[model samples]
Target: MWRSGSDAGAIAIGVVVEVPTPGTAVKHPEALGADLWRTDEPDLDEPRTGIRLQEIRLTSQEGFLPRVVVKADLALSSASIITMPNGTVFPLDATQANAMERLWGLTTSQSLPALPGASEGQRKLMSHYRRERSNTLRLKKLAEVRARHGKCVCALCGIDDSSKYPRQLSERIFEVHHLLPLATAATPVRTTLDDLVVLCASCHRAVHATSAVEDNYAVLAGHLRGES
Candidate 1:
Protein backbone atom coordinates (compact mmCIF):
# COMPACT_ATOMS: atom_id res chain seq x y z
CA MET A 1 0.00 0.00 0.00
CA TRP A 2 1.04 3.70 -0.41
CA ARG A 3 2.41 4.55 3.01
CA SER A 4 -0.01 6.75 4.91
CA GLY A 5 1.49 8.43 7.96
CA SER A 6 4.23 10.89 8.92
CA ASP A 7 5.77 9.85 5.59
CA ALA A 8 2.51 9.58 3.75
CA GLY A 9 3.95 11.14 0.61
CA ALA A 10 6.77 8.65 0.42
CA ILE A 11 6.83 6.12 -2.43
CA ALA A 12 6.94 2.75 -0.71
CA ILE A 13 8.31 -0.18 -2.69
CA GLY A 14 6.75 -3.62 -3.11
CA VAL A 15 7.20 -7.02 -4.76
CA VAL A 16 5.38 -7.49 -8.03
CA VAL A 17 3.33 -10.66 -8.27
CA GLU A 18 0.76 -11.45 -11.02
CA VAL A 19 -1.59 -9.04 -12.72
CA PRO A 20 -5.39 -9.26 -13.16
CA THR A 21 -7.24 -9.80 -16.41
CA PRO A 22 -10.73 -10.25 -17.89
CA GLY A 23 -10.99 -13.90 -17.02
CA THR A 24 -9.97 -13.51 -13.38
CA ALA A 25 -12.33 -11.01 -11.78
CA VAL A 26 -14.04 -11.95 -8.46
CA LYS A 27 -17.52 -10.86 -7.48
CA HIS A 28 -18.62 -9.21 -4.22
CA PRO A 29 -21.43 -10.80 -2.25
CA GLU A 30 -22.30 -7.48 -0.63
CA ALA A 31 -22.42 -5.74 -3.98
CA LEU A 32 -25.02 -8.26 -5.05
CA GLY A 33 -26.88 -7.81 -1.75
CA ALA A 34 -25.93 -11.15 -0.24
CA ASP A 35 -24.30 -12.02 3.09
CA LEU A 36 -20.87 -13.53 2.43
CA TRP A 37 -20.11 -15.87 5.37
CA ARG A 38 -23.64 -16.46 6.62
CA THR A 39 -22.79 -14.93 10.02
CA ASP A 40 -25.72 -16.48 11.82
CA GLU A 41 -24.77 -20.00 10.75
CA PRO A 42 -20.99 -19.83 10.57
CA ASP A 43 -19.97 -23.00 8.79
CA LEU A 44 -16.77 -24.21 10.42
CA ASP A 45 -16.59 -27.31 8.24
CA GLU A 46 -17.04 -25.43 4.95
CA PRO A 47 -14.66 -26.84 2.36
CA ARG A 48 -12.32 -24.58 0.41
CA THR A 49 -11.56 -26.68 -2.64
CA GLY A 50 -8.86 -26.09 -5.27
CA ILE A 51 -5.23 -25.01 -5.14
CA ARG A 52 -5.06 -21.25 -5.76
CA LEU A 53 -1.30 -21.23 -6.06
CA GLN A 54 -1.31 -23.47 -9.16
CA GLU A 55 -3.20 -20.89 -11.24
CA ILE A 56 -0.94 -17.87 -10.69
CA ARG A 57 -1.12 -16.49 -14.22
CA LEU A 58 -2.48 -13.30 -15.74
CA THR A 59 -4.66 -13.01 -18.86
CA SER A 60 -7.77 -11.08 -17.74
CA GLN A 61 -6.50 -7.89 -16.01
CA GLU A 62 -5.34 -5.80 -18.93
CA GLY A 63 -6.90 -2.48 -17.97
CA PHE A 64 -7.40 -3.22 -14.31
CA LEU A 65 -4.07 -1.72 -13.28
CA PRO A 66 -0.69 -0.90 -14.68
CA ARG A 67 1.27 -1.89 -11.58
CA VAL A 68 1.00 -2.78 -7.89
CA VAL A 69 3.11 -2.86 -4.68
CA VAL A 70 4.19 -5.37 -2.05
CA LYS A 71 6.21 -5.11 1.20
CA ALA A 72 9.45 -6.68 -0.13
CA ASP A 73 11.35 -9.97 -0.09
CA LEU A 74 14.87 -9.78 1.28
CA ALA A 75 15.26 -13.32 2.48
CA LEU A 76 14.81 -16.63 0.67
CA SER A 77 13.84 -15.01 -2.64
CA SER A 78 16.63 -12.45 -2.43
CA ALA A 79 18.10 -13.94 -5.64
CA SER A 80 15.05 -12.74 -7.61
CA ILE A 81 15.42 -9.10 -6.49
CA ILE A 82 16.26 -6.67 -9.24
CA THR A 83 16.64 -2.92 -9.81
CA MET A 84 13.50 -1.31 -11.20
CA PRO A 85 13.36 1.13 -14.10
CA ASN A 86 12.64 3.92 -11.63
CA GLY A 87 15.74 2.93 -9.69
CA THR A 88 13.67 1.51 -6.84
CA VAL A 89 13.12 -2.07 -5.77
CA PHE A 90 10.82 -3.26 -3.01
CA PRO A 91 12.22 -2.37 0.40
CA LEU A 92 14.49 -0.39 -1.95
CA ASP A 93 17.69 -1.69 -0.45
CA ALA A 94 20.32 -3.55 -2.45
CA THR A 95 23.39 -2.88 -0.33
CA GLN A 96 22.00 -4.50 2.82
CA ALA A 97 21.48 -8.06 4.03
CA ASN A 98 17.88 -7.29 5.01
CA ALA A 99 15.99 -4.25 3.89
CA MET A 100 13.64 -3.12 6.66
CA GLU A 101 11.24 -4.69 9.12
CA ARG A 102 7.81 -5.32 7.55
CA LEU A 103 5.13 -2.77 8.52
CA TRP A 104 2.03 -4.90 9.11
CA GLY A 105 0.48 -6.66 12.13
CA LEU A 106 0.63 -10.28 13.37
CA THR A 107 -1.67 -13.19 14.29
CA THR A 108 -2.10 -17.01 13.93
CA SER A 109 -5.62 -17.24 12.51
CA GLN A 110 -6.10 -18.81 9.03
CA SER A 111 -8.70 -18.67 6.27
CA LEU A 112 -9.51 -20.64 3.10
CA PRO A 113 -11.39 -20.09 -0.14
CA ALA A 114 -15.04 -20.77 0.60
CA LEU A 115 -16.78 -23.38 -1.53
CA PRO A 116 -20.53 -23.14 -0.99
CA GLY A 117 -21.66 -25.71 1.60
CA ALA A 118 -18.16 -27.22 1.69
CA SER A 119 -16.47 -27.52 5.11
CA GLU A 120 -12.95 -26.43 6.13
CA GLY A 121 -11.93 -29.95 7.15
CA GLN A 122 -13.11 -31.29 3.80
CA ARG A 123 -11.08 -28.67 1.97
CA LYS A 124 -7.95 -29.81 3.77
CA LEU A 125 -8.70 -33.41 2.86
CA MET A 126 -8.86 -32.40 -0.81
CA SER A 127 -5.70 -30.30 -0.81
CA HIS A 128 -2.44 -31.49 -2.41
CA TYR A 129 -0.27 -30.91 0.65
CA ARG A 130 -0.58 -32.32 4.17
CA ARG A 131 -2.89 -29.86 5.89
CA GLU A 132 -1.81 -31.01 9.33
CA ARG A 133 1.85 -30.27 8.63
CA SER A 134 1.29 -26.70 9.84
CA ASN A 135 -1.29 -25.95 7.16
CA THR A 136 -2.99 -23.07 9.03
CA LEU A 137 0.25 -21.45 10.08
CA ARG A 138 2.01 -22.08 6.76
CA LEU A 139 -0.82 -20.72 4.65
CA LYS A 140 -1.07 -17.62 6.84
CA LYS A 141 2.59 -16.98 7.74
CA LEU A 142 3.43 -14.41 5.07
CA ALA A 143 0.70 -12.11 6.28
CA GLU A 144 1.56 -12.97 9.86
CA VAL A 145 5.04 -11.57 9.30
CA ARG A 146 3.52 -8.47 7.81
CA ALA A 147 1.27 -8.01 10.80
CA ARG A 148 4.01 -8.69 13.28
CA HIS A 149 6.30 -6.02 11.85
CA GLY A 150 3.67 -3.41 11.26
CA LYS A 151 0.63 -2.77 13.45
CA CYS A 152 -1.94 -5.48 14.12
CA VAL A 153 -4.94 -4.55 12.07
CA CYS A 154 -7.81 -6.43 10.49
CA ALA A 155 -6.87 -6.21 6.82
CA LEU A 156 -10.41 -7.19 5.85
CA CYS A 157 -12.57 -5.15 8.21
CA GLY A 158 -10.18 -2.18 8.44
CA ILE A 159 -10.12 -2.67 12.22
CA ASP A 160 -7.13 -3.09 14.49
CA ASP A 161 -6.63 -6.50 16.18
CA SER A 162 -4.66 -5.23 19.16
CA SER A 163 -7.51 -6.05 21.51
CA LYS A 164 -7.00 -9.31 23.37
CA TYR A 165 -9.78 -11.88 23.12
CA PRO A 166 -11.30 -14.25 25.66
CA ARG A 167 -10.29 -17.25 23.57
CA GLN A 168 -13.39 -17.96 21.54
CA LEU A 169 -13.91 -18.57 17.83
CA SER A 170 -16.26 -15.56 17.79
CA GLU A 171 -14.02 -13.42 19.94
CA ARG A 172 -10.67 -12.65 18.24
CA ILE A 173 -8.05 -14.02 15.94
CA PHE A 174 -5.90 -11.78 13.77
CA GLU A 175 -5.84 -12.51 10.02
CA VAL A 176 -3.96 -11.49 6.89
CA HIS A 177 -6.14 -11.12 3.85
CA HIS A 178 -4.91 -11.14 0.23
CA LEU A 179 -5.96 -7.98 -1.60
CA LEU A 180 -5.79 -9.17 -5.20
CA PRO A 181 -7.24 -12.52 -4.22
CA LEU A 182 -4.15 -14.70 -4.61
CA ALA A 183 -6.34 -17.67 -5.54
CA THR A 184 -6.41 -16.44 -9.17
CA ALA A 185 -3.17 -14.36 -8.92
CA ALA A 186 -3.86 -12.30 -12.05
CA THR A 187 -4.68 -8.93 -10.58
CA PRO A 188 -1.44 -6.98 -11.20
CA VAL A 189 -0.80 -6.87 -7.46
CA ARG A 190 2.43 -7.38 -5.58
CA THR A 191 3.15 -10.48 -3.45
CA THR A 192 5.30 -8.98 -0.70
CA LEU A 193 3.99 -9.77 2.80
CA ASP A 194 2.73 -6.17 2.98
CA ASP A 195 0.17 -6.80 0.26
CA LEU A 196 -1.52 -9.45 2.37
CA VAL A 197 -2.82 -8.67 5.87
CA VAL A 198 -3.62 -9.16 9.55
CA LEU A 199 -7.35 -9.57 9.37
CA CYS A 200 -9.77 -11.61 11.47
CA ALA A 201 -10.92 -14.94 10.00
CA SER A 202 -14.48 -13.65 9.80
CA CYS A 203 -13.34 -10.66 7.73
CA HIS A 204 -11.02 -12.76 5.60
CA ARG A 205 -13.94 -14.99 4.59
CA ALA A 206 -15.85 -11.88 3.63
CA VAL A 207 -13.01 -11.35 1.18
CA HIS A 208 -13.18 -14.49 -1.03
CA ALA A 209 -16.67 -15.13 0.27
CA THR A 210 -18.05 -12.71 -2.29
CA SER A 211 -19.07 -14.75 -5.33
CA ALA A 212 -17.68 -17.06 -7.97
CA VAL A 213 -18.33 -14.52 -10.70
CA GLU A 214 -16.27 -11.32 -11.19
CA ASP A 215 -13.46 -10.35 -8.76
CA ASN A 216 -14.22 -7.66 -6.23
CA TYR A 217 -12.03 -4.65 -7.10
CA ALA A 218 -13.37 -2.42 -4.33
CA VAL A 219 -12.20 -4.80 -1.63
CA LEU A 220 -8.81 -4.95 -3.28
CA ALA A 221 -8.53 -1.17 -3.27
CA GLY A 222 -9.31 -0.80 0.44
CA HIS A 223 -7.64 -4.06 1.50
CA LEU A 224 -3.88 -3.67 1.97
CA ARG A 225 -3.62 0.01 2.84
CA GLY A 226 -2.60 -0.30 6.50
CA GLU A 227 0.60 -2.23 5.79
CA SER A 228 4.17 -1.06 5.28
Candidate 2:
Protein backbone atom coordinates (compact mmCIF):
# COMPACT_ATOMS: atom_id res chain seq x y z
CA MET A 1 0.00 0.00 0.00
CA TRP A 2 1.12 3.58 -0.69
CA ARG A 3 0.17 6.74 1.13
CA SER A 4 0.67 10.34 0.04
CA GLY A 5 1.36 13.26 2.35
CA SER A 6 2.15 16.91 1.91
CA ASP A 7 3.86 19.33 4.26
CA ALA A 8 5.20 22.80 3.61
CA GLY A 9 5.05 22.54 -0.20
CA ALA A 10 6.63 19.07 -0.42
CA ILE A 11 4.80 15.88 -1.37
CA ALA A 12 5.86 12.65 0.28
CA ILE A 13 5.05 9.19 -0.90
CA GLY A 14 5.31 6.31 1.57
CA VAL A 15 6.05 2.97 -0.03
CA VAL A 16 5.53 -0.37 1.70
CA VAL A 17 7.44 -3.29 0.31
CA GLU A 18 6.76 -6.94 1.07
CA VAL A 19 9.65 -8.92 2.41
CA PRO A 20 10.98 -11.53 0.02
CA THR A 21 11.45 -15.17 1.03
CA PRO A 22 14.40 -15.93 3.29
CA GLY A 23 17.71 -16.46 1.49
CA THR A 24 16.36 -14.61 -1.61
CA ALA A 25 18.53 -11.87 -2.99
CA VAL A 26 16.84 -8.49 -2.89
CA LYS A 27 18.07 -4.98 -3.48
CA HIS A 28 17.34 -2.27 -0.96
CA PRO A 29 14.61 0.07 -2.15
CA GLU A 30 16.93 3.03 -1.73
CA ALA A 31 19.61 1.23 -3.75
CA LEU A 32 17.42 0.76 -6.80
CA GLY A 33 18.22 4.07 -8.57
CA ALA A 34 19.33 7.49 -7.49
CA ASP A 35 16.73 9.35 -9.57
CA LEU A 36 13.95 6.84 -10.26
CA TRP A 37 11.92 4.46 -8.13
CA ARG A 38 9.28 1.81 -8.73
CA THR A 39 5.77 2.12 -7.37
CA ASP A 40 3.00 -0.43 -7.41
CA GLU A 41 0.07 1.94 -7.38
CA PRO A 42 -1.19 2.81 -10.87
CA ASP A 43 -4.76 4.06 -10.43
CA LEU A 44 -3.61 7.42 -9.07
CA ASP A 45 -5.31 10.66 -10.12
CA GLU A 46 -5.28 10.47 -13.90
CA PRO A 47 -5.68 14.18 -14.55
CA ARG A 48 -2.55 15.43 -12.77
CA THR A 49 -0.02 12.95 -14.10
CA GLY A 50 3.38 13.64 -15.65
CA ILE A 51 4.28 16.61 -13.47
CA ARG A 52 8.03 17.27 -13.64
CA LEU A 53 9.95 16.43 -10.50
CA GLN A 54 12.83 18.72 -9.53
CA GLU A 55 14.25 16.88 -6.55
CA ILE A 56 13.46 13.82 -4.43
CA ARG A 57 14.47 12.65 -1.00
CA LEU A 58 14.37 9.09 0.19
CA THR A 59 14.38 8.28 3.90
CA SER A 60 14.18 4.93 5.65
CA GLN A 61 11.93 4.17 8.58
CA GLU A 62 13.73 3.65 11.89
CA GLY A 63 12.57 0.11 12.50
CA PHE A 64 13.08 -3.48 11.40
CA LEU A 65 12.15 -3.95 7.75
CA PRO A 66 12.09 -0.24 7.20
CA ARG A 67 9.70 1.41 4.78
CA VAL A 68 10.96 3.99 2.30
CA VAL A 69 9.60 7.53 2.22
CA VAL A 70 9.91 9.61 -0.91
CA LYS A 71 9.62 13.36 -0.72
CA ALA A 72 9.45 15.08 -4.10
CA ASP A 73 9.37 18.66 -5.29
CA LEU A 74 6.03 17.96 -6.97
CA ALA A 75 3.33 15.33 -6.96
CA LEU A 76 4.15 12.16 -8.90
CA SER A 77 1.92 9.96 -11.02
CA SER A 78 2.20 6.39 -12.20
CA ALA A 79 1.95 7.55 -15.80
CA SER A 80 5.45 8.99 -15.46
CA ILE A 81 6.82 5.53 -14.84
CA ILE A 82 8.40 3.31 -17.49
CA THR A 83 7.97 -0.42 -17.84
CA MET A 84 11.18 -2.35 -17.99
CA PRO A 85 11.94 -5.50 -20.02
CA ASN A 86 11.30 -7.60 -16.91
CA GLY A 87 7.83 -5.95 -16.61
CA THR A 88 8.70 -3.85 -13.54
CA VAL A 89 7.54 -0.24 -13.57
CA PHE A 90 9.84 2.63 -12.57
CA PRO A 91 9.27 6.35 -12.40
CA LEU A 92 11.11 8.40 -15.01
CA ASP A 93 13.87 10.71 -13.77
CA ALA A 94 13.83 14.34 -14.87
CA THR A 95 17.16 13.93 -16.65
CA GLN A 96 15.94 10.77 -18.37
CA ALA A 97 12.78 12.57 -19.49
CA ASN A 98 14.89 15.30 -21.13
CA ALA A 99 17.01 12.70 -22.88
CA MET A 100 13.86 10.94 -24.10
CA GLU A 101 12.55 14.26 -25.45
CA ARG A 102 15.74 14.77 -27.47
CA LEU A 103 15.56 11.19 -28.72
CA TRP A 104 11.97 11.76 -29.82
CA GLY A 105 13.03 14.84 -31.77
CA LEU A 106 15.75 12.91 -33.55
CA THR A 107 13.40 10.03 -34.26
CA THR A 108 10.81 12.35 -35.80
CA SER A 109 13.44 14.12 -37.88
CA GLN A 110 14.34 10.80 -39.49
CA SER A 111 11.14 11.12 -41.53
CA LEU A 112 12.28 14.40 -43.05
CA PRO A 113 15.06 14.85 -45.58
CA ALA A 114 18.30 16.45 -44.38
CA LEU A 115 19.03 20.10 -45.16
CA PRO A 116 22.01 21.10 -47.29
CA GLY A 117 24.38 22.39 -44.60
CA ALA A 118 22.89 21.31 -41.26
CA SER A 119 20.33 18.55 -40.95
CA GLU A 120 17.06 19.15 -39.09
CA GLY A 121 18.09 16.66 -36.41
CA GLN A 122 21.39 18.41 -35.82
CA ARG A 123 19.73 21.82 -35.59
CA LYS A 124 17.09 20.58 -33.16
CA LEU A 125 19.66 18.84 -30.94
CA MET A 126 21.97 21.84 -30.85
CA SER A 127 19.18 24.31 -30.20
CA HIS A 128 17.75 22.14 -27.43
CA TYR A 129 21.12 21.66 -25.75
CA ARG A 130 22.04 25.34 -25.94
CA ARG A 131 18.67 26.50 -24.62
CA GLU A 132 18.85 24.15 -21.62
CA ARG A 133 22.46 24.96 -20.84
CA SER A 134 21.94 28.70 -21.23
CA ASN A 135 18.85 28.75 -19.05
CA THR A 136 20.66 27.00 -16.18
CA LEU A 137 23.66 29.30 -16.51
CA ARG A 138 21.47 32.38 -16.79
CA LEU A 139 19.79 31.71 -13.46
CA LYS A 140 23.13 31.17 -11.76
CA LYS A 141 24.55 34.34 -13.28
CA LEU A 142 21.55 36.37 -12.21
CA ALA A 143 21.81 35.14 -8.63
CA GLU A 144 25.53 35.80 -8.50
CA VAL A 145 25.17 39.30 -9.94
CA ARG A 146 22.36 40.20 -7.60
CA ALA A 147 24.27 38.90 -4.58
CA ARG A 148 27.47 40.77 -5.44
CA HIS A 149 26.06 44.02 -6.90
CA GLY A 150 22.65 44.16 -5.14
CA LYS A 151 21.04 44.59 -8.58
CA CYS A 152 21.51 43.66 -12.21
CA VAL A 153 22.66 46.37 -14.64
CA CYS A 154 23.29 46.24 -18.35
CA ALA A 155 27.01 46.22 -18.99
CA LEU A 156 26.75 47.89 -22.39
CA CYS A 157 23.94 50.45 -22.10
CA GLY A 158 24.44 51.19 -18.38
CA ILE A 159 20.73 50.91 -17.76
CA ASP A 160 19.49 49.76 -14.35
CA ASP A 161 15.87 48.84 -14.96
CA SER A 162 15.38 48.13 -11.28
CA SER A 163 15.49 51.87 -10.70
CA LYS A 164 12.70 52.45 -13.24
CA TYR A 165 10.50 49.39 -12.81
CA PRO A 166 9.40 46.93 -10.16
CA ARG A 167 11.97 44.38 -9.08
CA GLN A 168 10.17 41.47 -10.75
CA LEU A 169 9.61 43.44 -13.95
CA SER A 170 13.16 44.73 -13.99
CA GLU A 171 14.51 41.24 -13.58
CA ARG A 172 12.53 40.15 -16.62
CA ILE A 173 14.19 42.90 -18.66
CA PHE A 174 17.72 41.74 -17.83
CA GLU A 175 19.36 38.81 -19.52
CA VAL A 176 22.63 36.91 -19.14
CA HIS A 177 24.61 37.09 -22.35
CA HIS A 178 27.28 34.51 -23.14
CA LEU A 179 30.59 35.96 -24.37
CA LEU A 180 31.32 32.84 -26.44
CA PRO A 181 28.74 30.95 -28.44
CA LEU A 182 27.97 27.58 -26.86
CA ALA A 183 27.93 25.95 -30.30
CA THR A 184 31.54 26.98 -30.99
CA ALA A 185 32.95 24.57 -28.39
CA ALA A 186 34.20 21.30 -29.84
CA THR A 187 33.60 19.61 -26.47
CA PRO A 188 31.81 20.44 -23.24
CA VAL A 189 33.51 23.44 -21.69
CA ARG A 190 33.27 24.64 -18.09
CA THR A 191 31.47 27.99 -17.99
CA THR A 192 32.66 30.66 -15.57
CA LEU A 193 31.14 33.96 -14.46
CA ASP A 194 33.80 35.71 -16.58
CA ASP A 195 32.17 34.24 -19.66
CA LEU A 196 28.84 35.96 -18.92
CA VAL A 197 27.72 39.60 -19.02
CA VAL A 198 24.50 41.17 -17.88
CA LEU A 199 22.50 43.07 -20.52
CA CYS A 200 19.07 44.60 -20.66
CA ALA A 201 16.55 43.45 -23.23
CA SER A 202 17.26 46.18 -25.79
CA CYS A 203 21.05 45.98 -25.58
CA HIS A 204 20.91 42.18 -25.69
CA ARG A 205 18.84 42.27 -28.86
CA ALA A 206 21.29 44.73 -30.45
CA VAL A 207 24.24 42.55 -29.48
CA HIS A 208 22.56 39.59 -31.17
CA ALA A 209 21.43 41.59 -34.20
CA THR A 210 24.18 39.92 -36.24
CA SER A 211 26.81 37.25 -35.78
CA ALA A 212 29.48 39.94 -36.03
CA VAL A 213 27.90 41.97 -33.20
CA GLU A 214 28.69 39.17 -30.72
CA ASP A 215 32.44 39.57 -31.36
CA ASN A 216 32.28 43.40 -31.41
CA TYR A 217 31.00 44.41 -27.99
CA ALA A 218 33.11 47.57 -28.12
CA VAL A 219 31.59 48.60 -31.44
CA LEU A 220 28.08 47.98 -30.17
CA ALA A 221 28.77 50.01 -27.03
CA GLY A 222 30.19 52.81 -29.16
CA HIS A 223 27.03 52.93 -31.30
CA LEU A 224 24.88 52.95 -28.19
CA ARG A 225 26.88 55.92 -26.90
CA GLY A 226 26.40 57.77 -30.25
CA GLU A 227 30.18 57.76 -30.78
CA SER A 228 31.70 57.65 -34.31
Error of 1 at 33 (Å): 40
Question: Over the stretch 34-138, how does candidate 2's per-residue lDDT look in tens digits?
Answer: 222245533222221222222222232211111121222122322233222223344557655444344323234444565577543242322212222435567
Tally clashing residue pairs in candidate 2: 0
* TM-score of candidate 1 versus the correct structure, residues matched by position: 0.28
Candidate 1 residue-wise lDDT, 43-65, digit = tens: 43332222223111122221111
- Candidate 1's displacement at residue 202, Å, is 1.7
- Candidate 2 ranges beyond 4 A from true positions: 1-136
Best-fitting candidate, measured by TM-score? 2
Q: Give the lowest summed-lDDT range of ten residues in model 2.
A: 62-71
